[model samples]
Target chain A: MSLGCELSDLQLDALRELMNIGFGQAAAALSEVIDLRVILTVPKILVLKPEEVPAFIDAEVEMPSSFSMVEQFFFGHFEGTSFLLLPEEEGRKLASLFGAEAAPLPPELETGSLERETVVEIGNIIIGACVGKIAEILKDQVAFQAPRFIEAPVDRSSLERRLAGAKDLALVFKTVFHFERQDVFGFLFLVASEGSLEWMRAAVDEYLGSLA
Target chain B: MGFKVLIVDDSMVARLAIKGIVKDSVDSLAEASSGEAALDLLAGGREPDLVFLDLTMPGMGGIEALKAIRSGHPSVKVAVVTADIQARTLAEVRACGAYEVIRKPADRAAVLALVSRARGEGAAP
Candidate 1:
């Protein structure tokens, strides 16, 4: 389906490579933190109008009906949010990696609690590392907001808060994350704010030039 | 006289990385987190032989900053560094008086080369 994106073919290709680099850096950082070989892969990347985002998410994301998620926003060079969504079982397993048991309630007990801290750490490293690496490569500076734990069946308000009143477009990247031989029911999403598409277009253009 | 250099970027990591890039040739090093800060330093009389200016910033982007600097401080050398490059935009930057456009992910050699070219051979620390 056409999303009305203005990126040229070359720009799109360059963006794919940049996304690979950005996520690859995140995976590497996560691996170091968890002391395991973590693999992060982006299966697809799409730029959609704000109105087109919901349907795209419904069809593409197809995330677990109910789940635990962690999300954080990164600002500066490119404004955007990164989300980590995990199914109940996968959420439990991931928390186990950081010493939290599967819970009947929300993923976190309370903000600032140890369990929540673990989730925050995961979100922080993944989001900060990815955006940080990207900013560094671009020779720009990007600041990250503190991460928060989210529960699925997300409220519309929470969804709208990401790019509230943003006037540009959004680039959505679907990331698949896992450990060696472990079927981790998890997904990673990088959502850029409005006006970011242009910034990204320019970045990809420059990135390609550097390669040339 | 050793070369005095100013690195402008919002990211501390980038400033440090750029500093390392030109460290061997630089006798004086300064950093600014934004274009406005860079200008403030310049206005405050911190004269540098060259400046590595990042394009994407919050308050005043590199383009505007470059324009102001070119008009006000014609003698200072500024290199535009950014991940965004297009023939049109690159031309615009050069037209605004950038010594050169250095694409991001810049290596040490490229940085040193730019510094040497800006400062002239045997002009560095």
Candidate 2:
């Protein structure tokens, strides 16, 4: 285990297998939506205390600017935060897909009914698939809220302030998504409450038992 | 006649953003979740006056779609609407013959303004 919390060899293997299944499902959903064969590299899973979270990603990516989506969800097994990172150029490219001639700034989305529907839908599918898979792995049911599109650059101070209020350790898993010959990279962090971590330990023990 | 539009992005949200920007100027809206889907929509005989595309996806990405549309539907105007704003990405959009590029998290006014320009209602520069 990357975090100080240790699991038995059997438990670790079981947990890894479960995560693999979840990631696989996410890959399939993405492939279907994009109409292309999406290859999701095996996720790099690690457990980290809050202080170690920054080292997990590109330092400059701290304030992920550009058109992006953030979703937070919780299931019985775990609670997760997912960031769908699109390159700034990719955002412009998407606008062109709808017929825009100039580069659209963050202030430009309020113009149509259909674009609103479409943006929410896209966010739903990507985040839903990723989290749903994790839920399945843990054999827990998952539910989701409507997508909240962040139209502005995220303020790092605000994000840090929110994280500071959390009651448990955070685990960071970075997954790279390559779609339709383009690279769309994203990051996912699973935050476990202190109580949830205790539950996780028991669940891990049970899963490991099943594997053995 | 109002223009016909094509929206391409793996994110349903991005596609919706494009539709929001262009709906006022366009008559009908068609969607493709990926580069291949965009090509498929065109291949099925839908001639879009304009296309909004995302650069990064799982399979057929924006560049490939641009090439396909250029060869297959040369008359269609394509714009790159994505968050990948790296210089190389923009250069690729230029090479692909994209009419323009729009950044992500597009606001209502920007959407309206850009679509107006794409339709030649506003000066593109």
Candidate 3:
């Protein structure tokens, strides 16, 4: 249940502020992209062991057809990955919003056209904006891999395998984005190596110390 | 003396937004991506009348940068420009000798007032 993430009250508080800034910036960028008033909220943040995500997902989300995923890995000074997981049907809805070929019947939405582009690019904006803000705040040079989009049904075992890191701890952020009366629910799941977590803890401590 | 301003933030997005606000008022502008870079500029003899600081930068976050600038250049004024407007560090920034705190998504008018207050250009705090 616990992956030795002993972020204190102060650390958690600091993390909340940091995440707020990062997610807020991302949501603003998304609003511009979708051309709507987008409200982003982080309802929960859980620092958990790697195996816990599947169970958590199984309990929370009911639809099996809505699994769309993208994973971006960042390294250098810290080793970890962040995954954006949502429903494919919802993703198609997002694509449609961008004037692209979404799930059912759009003859004009071609593979290389705006629809497919939107399907791929949404991940880029959401993941890039969030990760970029976090990196900027931390002042760390994080090299990130291209986001790998997986269009498939939500599978527990496969997700666990993809995210498996024996010594790494996960920081699961429950984020919601609502635009024009439509709600898109997703998770920004970050798992960092134990060493990186310790380093991050010290770094946060230094940040607070500077504030004091 | 004319305004010499230093804008510190890792995001070029933020810096660009801040620059638009400061361009007319402060003719000579300086920029630092990290807190350390800002200090280095100050140490290297680029003395700005006001500094627009961001709180959550990676290298030298705004608070430490504020401490450094205030400690070394007590006369120089710093106004924090951050999205974390309600952060507890606001009090600390004031305590550590920052002149004012400005929220993020800064526009020209908002920044202008804060900058003016920082430099004693306007009466209101």
Q: What DockQ results do all the predictions give, each relative to the true complex?
A: 0.02, 0.01, 0.05
Instruction: Provide the clash count, candidate 1.
Output: 0
- Report the lDDT tens digits of candidate 3 across residue range A132-212: 666666666677898777756647778888867546678777777666657777777878877788778877676556443
What's the DockQ of model 3? 0.05
Candidates 2 and 3: which is better by DockQ? 3
How would you encode candidate 2's per-residue C-alpha lDDT over A118-212 as one tens digit per residue? 34455566567656655554566766655666543444443455467565567566666555566656666666666667666776665444332
Q: In model 3, which regions exceed 4 Å deviation?
A: A100-116, B1-125
Sorted into a CAPRI-style docking class, model 2 comes out as: incorrect
Give the alpha carbon lDDT tens digit for every residue of B1-125 in model 1: 57899999765545656776777787999999888999999999987889898775557888889998888788999998764443445677899999877875567778888888887883433
lDDT of 2 at A94: 37
Residue A134 lDDT in candidate 3 = 63
Per-candidate TM equals: 0.53, 0.50, 0.62
lDDT of 1 at B54: 77
What is every candidate's alpha-carbon RMSD to the true fold?
16.3, 17.9, 12.7
Worst 10 residues of 1 chain A by lDDT: A97-106
Given candidate 2, what's the lDDT at residue A76?
58
